[model samples]
Target: MTRGNRILLSCIYWAFVLYVFVPLLLMILMGFKDSKFIGFPIKSWTLDWYLGVFSDAEVVSTLTYSVVIAVLSTLISVVVGTWIAVLLEGRKFLGRAAIFGLTILPALVPGIISAIAFRIYARLLGIEPGMGAIIWAHAVHNVPFVALVVMARLSTLPKSQIEAARDLGADPIIAFLRITLPYLIPAVLGASIFCLLLSFDDFVRSFFLGGYEPTLPVLIFAKLRSGMSPEINAIATVALVLTAAIGIWAERFTRRTNKDAKP
Candidate 1:
C-alpha cells in the first residue's frame, strides 16, 4: 500500500526480468554485431551472419532434423500422455503409484543419464542411434510432462459428464470421444506446444542419440567448440526468439484458461 513497497516491488520485478532475458538479449545483439567474438563494444552491425544460416547447407539440414523430431515426438507424447493421465488420475489400482512414478521417471532423470540409457537400449535392440532413437527419447521425455499438464486440467474437470454420457446409451469409447476428449482438447494442445519446445531445444539427449545426423543444438555446440563464428550467434538469436514467442503464447493461453475456468 505504501510508495516504498510499490517501488521495491517494481525493482524486484525488473531485476527478475533482466536476469532472465539479459543474457539472451546479449546473444541476439552479438549476432548482429560485426565482431567475431562475443564481447562488449560492438563496433558494427551486419545481417551477414543471419544470411550465413540459410547459406550453409549443413545448418539448414540440421534445423530440418530438429523440426522433424520435435513434431514427431510431440505427437507421440500428446496421445500417449493424455491416455496415461486419463487412466492414472484419481484411480486406485495395485502398483498405480509405482506406474505413475515410472511413467514420469524420464523427466526427473538427468539428460546425460537418459542419453546413456537410450544408447544401451538401442544397441541391445539392434537399432542404431539416429532419427528414430532421438525421436523415441524425446517422446519418452515429453510424455510425463504432457500427462502432468493434462492431469492437472482433468483434476478440475467433473467426472459426472462422462457418467451421464454412459448412462445415455453411449459406450466407453463414445463417451470418451464425445465427452472427455473434447474437454481435454485445450490442455492437449498446450501440452503439445510445450513438448515440441522441449524436443526442439534438447541438446544432451539428442547429442548422444543423434548418431551420424546432428540436430541444430548439436551443430551449435560444435561451432562453439570449433572457433568464433557469428553464425552461431545468429542461430542462437533465432532460437531465442522462437522460444520466447512460444513461451509468451503458452503463458497467455494459461492465463486465459484460468479466467475461463472462473465461475
Candidate 2:
C-alpha cells in the first residue's frame, strides 16, 4: 500500500470505469438525437426515438417475447441447476465428476458453437425453431452458472442444520425443504437475475432457434441490417437501463435476504 501504488491503482480503476461508462453514456446520448442516423455532432435532439420504442407495437411485442423467454429459461435452469448442485455438493457418487463436467460444459462452449449445436439438436428432435427452442437453449446454457452459484452457497451452509433436522425424524426431502432450500434462496435469486439478463441479452441462440417472430435481440439485429439509427440506440439504452435496475435491485435484495437468513 505505497502512495505511488495507490495512485497507480486508482488511475487504473478510473480508466476502467471510463472505458465502460463512456460508451454507455454515448449510447444514451445518441438515443436522444433528432436525426434518423447515428453519428457525432448532434445538431438537434428529441425524445421521439425513445417514445417510438413504446409506441411501436412490434418493439413492444418483441420486448415482451424476450422477457417471457428469459423468465421461462431462468425458471428451468434454476430448478435443474439447483437440483444438480444439491445432488453433487457433498456427494461421492461414482459418476459425480462426469456429471459435474457435463453440466458445466455448455457454459464453456463458445456461443456460436453452442447455438449451432442447439440448432442441430433441436432439428433432430423435431423441435421447431421458436420459443420452446430458445428457452431450451438458454436454460441449458444458463444451468452451469446457476449450479456454480448455488454450489458456492451450499458450501457455506452449516452441516449441523441438516443433521439437526434429520435427528428430529425429518426425512431427506423434509430436511432439504425445511433447511437447505431456505438457505439457498439468496443464491437462487441472484442466479435467477443473472440468468434472466443472460437470456434476454442472448442473440446467437435466439437468432438460430427463433421462428418468424423475433426476440428483442433478434429484432435489434434485423433492424441493424437496415442500418443503425437513433431508434436502435434508444432500444438498447432502454434495455440496458432495465437490466441494470434489475441487477441493482437483486443485489440489494439478496444482501438483505442473507442478513435475515443469518441466525
Candidate 3:
C-alpha cells in the first residue's frame, strides 16, 4: 500500500477505536461531574462521587466479591483449560472431537441460556445459587476460551522438542513440565487474564447464580434499575480503567515472553 493509503488506514483504525471508547471517556468525565444526574458536558468537577463510591459498603462488598470470584475462576480455568488443551493437542484418541466439542459448548451457547441451565442444574444438585455457582459457571465458559488459545500455542510448538525430551529418559510428566509447559506459559497467562475479565464483567451469569451476594455487575444492574447516578459512572470508570490496564499488561507480557522465546 502507498504511504497515503497507510496513513488513511491508520486514521480509520483510530477513528474506530475512538468510536468504541467515546462512551467510556464520557463516563470517566461524568464520574468527576458535580451534577446529581449523569449528563454530557460537566457543569463542575469534584471528587465527591468517587468518594461516595468508596464509602458505599454495598458497593465495596460487591467489588470484593467480583475480585475474589474473578481471581478464583481465572485460576481454575487456566489450570483445567491448559490441561485439556495439552491432552487434546498432545494425544490422539477416539471420540476426541466429542470431548473437545463438549468442553467448548458452554462458550458457544448464549449466556442467558447457559445461566438458566446452570441455575436449574445447581438447584437439582442441591447447591444454592451463590458465589460458588457463579465461579463454576464462569469457569465453565472460560475453559473453552482458554483451551482454544493454549491449543493454538501448542499447535505452533516444535513436536521434536517434546519427542526429544521423552527420548532422553524424561517421563511424560517431566517432559510436559519442561518442554510443553514453558511454551504454553504466555498463552496460559493471556487466557487467565481474559478469564478474569470475563468473570468480573459478566452480568447475566452472575445475576442468575448470585442469590444473595451480588457481584459488581449485578450490583450495577440493581443500582441502574432504581436510577442513574454519577456514582455509577464513577464505579464504571474505575472498572473500565482497571480492566484496560489488565488487558494491556497481559498482552504486553504475552508478546514480550513470546519474542524472548524466539530462537
**Using lDDT as the measure, which candidate wins?**
2
lDDT by residue for model 3 (1-263), tens: 89999999999999999999897787788889888887766778999999998898888888898999999999999999998998898678999999999989988999889999989998888878888999988988899999999999999899899899999999999998999888888888889999999999999999998878889888878888999989889888778888899999988998898898788
Q: Please, what is the TM-score per model? A: 0.93, 0.96, 0.93
> What is candidate 1's TM-score against the reference?
0.93
Residue-pair clash count for candidate 1: 0
Q: Which of 1 and 2 is ahead in lDDT? A: 2
lDDT of each: 0.89, 0.95, 0.89
lDDT of 2 by residue, 94-169 (tens): 9999999998999999999999999999999999999999999999999999999999999999999899999999
lDDT of 1 by residue, 1-263 (tens): 99999999999999999999898788888889886777888999999999988898988888888999999999999999999999998899999999899989999998889889988998888777899999998998899999999999888778888889989999999998998888788799889989989999999989998888898888889889988677899987777777779989987997787787667
lDDT (Cα, 0-100) at 94 in candidate 3: 100
Off by over 4 Å in 1: 1-6
Order of models, best TM-score first: 2, 1, 3
What is the Cα-based lDDT of residue 216 in candidate 3?
88
> Which scores higher on lDDT, 2 or 3?
2
- Give the CA lDDT, 0 to 100, for residue 240 in model 2: 90
What shift in Å separates residue 154 of candidate 3 from its native position after superposition? 1.4
Error of 2 at 36 (Å): 1.4
